[model samples]
Target: MGPRKITAHGDKGAEVQGKIRRLGSWRRAAAMIVAVGTVWAGTVMPASADTDLPEYLTKMRAPEMWKVADGTGITVAVIDSGVKDLPELEGRVLPGVSFMEPPVSRPEEKYPVHDDFEGHGTSMIAAIVGDGSGGGPHGLAPGAKVMPIRTSIGSPMAFGAIGEAGKGVRYAADNGAKIINLSIGGWWSLDRIGPAIEYAQSKGVLVFVGMGNDGSKMSNPIAALPGAFGVGAVDINGEPLESSSNGSATDFAAFGGKVPIRCKKNTAWCMQDGGTSYATSLASASAALVWSAHPDWTANQVARVLLQTAGGPVDGAKRNDWVGYGIARPSKVLIDRQGDPGAPDTDPLASPTPQPSTPSADPAAAVPPQAESTAAESDRSWKWPALGAAVAVILGLGITGILKRRRR
Candidate 1:
């Protein structure tokens, strides 16, 4: 099997390529992954209707019993296209600033800034913190509020620049946002945004980001933001979304369903896995729920607990390249209530020893960082898209004789 951007060390030293793709407004960017099974794609969207939330949540539950307290009083800042006021999220999302360069008018075309043209930002916010109501997509923490910070230059990201988002994350943290969800990435091989994450961590803020959709089959940046949790997405059947990127950088996994935005009112035509961006939001929202229950935990402590208690436990001792720490289960943190949430000054993910990968070299993802399939509808793009492109040719790390690791 050919390798996509991200590959796992497989049996007999062969790289098992996993398939993946990305669907969006500008161009439908896609990737390839060679795995034991399955294929993937990018970009597909869904509606904010009530019918799809339960099944997704049930899949996330993974037979685990995590009951995180309602995440009230916490604010997760979303830095992407922008969020609109939908019925399901009415009054739940708060208004924030736009780092969208020369900026546009909202409410209508720009100013007041909550228009989700790309649809990537809208899906990410809903996945992380939407309050399940009247048949909606239930959030990882349904009660936590969101802060929208639009930064997309539009559609896909610039190949090697930070765009406008680097500034936005810092602004959100500086202005009192406790959680920042960055569901986007770029391709610049530069160490551009470090201090922002450190600065946010200092404020006791938790940052969640997506590993690039490219790495699900390529050797590139797998969302490795410092002090930020790198998240990967999986499909509804409790399987890894073939396109979900992975690496030592990945902190955890979440249900980023194969979606088709089945509209409830008018405006139909939606389906796609919100990609890795939505996955990161789910990680942020899950952390929000765990933190809301404790209210006294540090960001590190929250992350550590997630790693220790992930559902669908893995096989060996090494951290997974694809599903880092397995699927995150907030229920594990709340139901049994593990972890000490460390002092406000301590970092929970602070390793006693150095990990195998370098921290600052993440290759940056494309704009609207991640994608997801939506609503009650699911897409089989895993098989459809680019069948003719000479995509992946599995490299590095043998796929055979791979060992699994034990988790907390």
Candidate 2:
């Protein structure tokens, strides 16, 4: 069984402040280019021109993993801002489709499929499959190819296009993409993308999503979904990042604190940034490595191995809201030969069904017979309050106004 769900603890004022800070960063990026739940920490400050392999690669033991598998035959579709053809990712990014029109500011460009104005998707691509040419950041799985899918999420708009994001997920599934990396999330519900994620799962594709950076008690909609593997962020010490979101939806954690990335304003140097987006990318690359090594393994088996090999929570729980199965350790499977491949069709992370309860036969019960309730009744009892709490959290996040505006 998965670990029991735990309630998140933090200062309410601090959470609100963090949410404001996160929204401010998104708006700033949107000013230059559009954004969805890109989960970028924004270049806080410049770092030395040290373009060495990121600490995360070492943490995940990517070098050791590469000795066994480098994801040579796998394709990870990045569904977000388009990917740029940087030297680090040259010949690795496929010519992906764009569901949105070209940026109004860049009409001269016929195809915005490769235009990464926000630089979010480009960084994500480099994080997944960069070859480290010209002293750029080295990706975790350098042999994996990236498929870029452009959408309004990367545009200079305010709100995200949920419908377009859904379409992008479906497109990646229909294409040759074996893994779809959706490092995007939002304050609003992701109901629109549910069916598309389901479609991908049906096609033997694994989808990885980022748990947002608002420091909220619950994960964003994308991560909250079942078919998607929700990823959170951890620092070098393997502790959850301070800004990382947590909830029942979080599936795993990865190095997301101050990892190396090509500076957005200047590609000549590398800078340190952090976010759940990077964590998601690293998790997706970890899956790619395992998938490449075991090409014949079904998606379910690959997922099961990941769950089996993951590091347990610090509290000794089977899982937790903050880190889910725990930190991703692909090297365990690649080098140590750990984790069971398990059944080909069973999803290791699937929620367990609650067994029905039967009435006690003892006549010495002190409570009246009318006090007895069926299991379904007990289940329904918590449903409304849980839902009400969720709604309250959304309203507190200022999403109610957005929903009302959209309805208009």
Candidate 3:
């Protein structure tokens, strides 16, 4: 298999570039943006090929697990650029909102609600609940419905990126989203979105966030926020990718590197595009599989089961910063009936320390506390190649310079 071509809408290239720049250091920004490009290196397959499935599913034994639960009745909210109306997602996308607009608005009459500005959101949605129609890749939870919440990370029209993200999370939680998947990440502190995250957790909605692709240069604050399930990327060998961020905040790992995905604008399927963003989607879908099977379970119970059944080091002393509890094995949790669901009111990731009786003077002090992970920072070289000079004009020279400097 070889790389396949993926086209983006003409207007979106600038938007993506601008978004990347605002994300932080040019190097980290480029890593996140280019992570999607890796799909071009994957085996190009036709949209009509129905028999094929992504390797990660096969490795996880999704078919064996599907007999018990196919994620029916669960709604996973995808908070990203936007989801595209593709054949794979037909009838599965529920009404969603675009928080980029003030007061938020439904899709206008001119465009579909899921009309993706960049291919990233569509790819994340497909990875969570694509039905595998038209030969597209099947999601881990094909029976799950997705609520697409369109949010712009760096657009001029975007409110503060963090504020919009917080609004999106609150909206999804209020609208019956059982699992919220945030495939976008940055270095911002949790102060901006802490309240929204707390609100979702209070409502018993599970939230999953990407650990970012900055290697060890920086960590995503969203991942560090209490109640957010931070997910990192791993290769087929079950090893964490060098590009995956490491920290106490990352709780799980999933296939994010060299993975196949349905492209945003192009008809062809992409092979190798991925990062922690994709990993977050898979983790969210995995939760859907479990939550759908046991609708009565609270968000904490579901999260506990996942942590209990995750694969990796059995020894309590081993370093797991990069991979966390290891690869997500929803099949193990479902088919093997692993882990106790525990009390509905108790949170698995809750801190044992007592809280202060009084409020702090600093508003930022409201952010919840987090227990740190023991995972060591990665010392490996950046794995992805830089987008060449020809592509720089499209992505911007300043962005390219940042990536080059980071590589050095």
Per-residue CA lDDT of model 3 for 1-408, tens digit only, reads 222121211232342233334445545443432222123334675655565776778888888878989889999998876777787788888889876553235444233446665566777888887877776668889889999887654243332344567888999989999999987654322354666887798889999888776565244555655467778887766656666775655677788766556553444566654778888999999999999889999998898787766765333322255656556788867887877788888876552211111222322111111332223433222122333212322333332222211000
Each candidate structure's TM-score, on Cα atoms with residue i matched to residue i, is 0.68, 0.74, 0.73
| True-structure lDDT of candidate 1 | 0.52
Full candidate order by TM-score, most accurate first: 2, 3, 1
- Model 1 TM-score? 0.68
Distance from true position, residue 267, model 1, in Å? 4.3
lDDT string, candidate 1, 201-225, tens digits: 7777877777655433331232444
User: What is the Cα root-mean-square deviation between model 2 and the actual structure?
Assistant: 13.2
> lDDT per prediction?
0.52, 0.64, 0.63
Q: Is candidate 1 or candidate 3 better by TM-score?
A: 3
Clashing pairs in 3: 3-40, 38-272, 38-273, 39-272, 39-273, 42-271, 248-373, 321-375
The lDDT-based order of candidates, best leading, equals 2, 3, 1
lDDT (tens digit, per residue) of candidate 2 on 1-408: 343344332342343344334433332222211121333333533433435566667667778789999989999999877877777788788889876554468766554678766667777888898877666668888898899988655444414444567888999999999999987765423455766787788899999988766554435555545478888877776767655666656777777777555454334434554467888998899999999999999888887777776765644456666677777778878998987787777665553311111112211101111121111111100011233234423433453222211000
Badly placed stretches (over 4 Å) of model 2 are 1-51, 102-111, 187-189, 265-269, 351-408
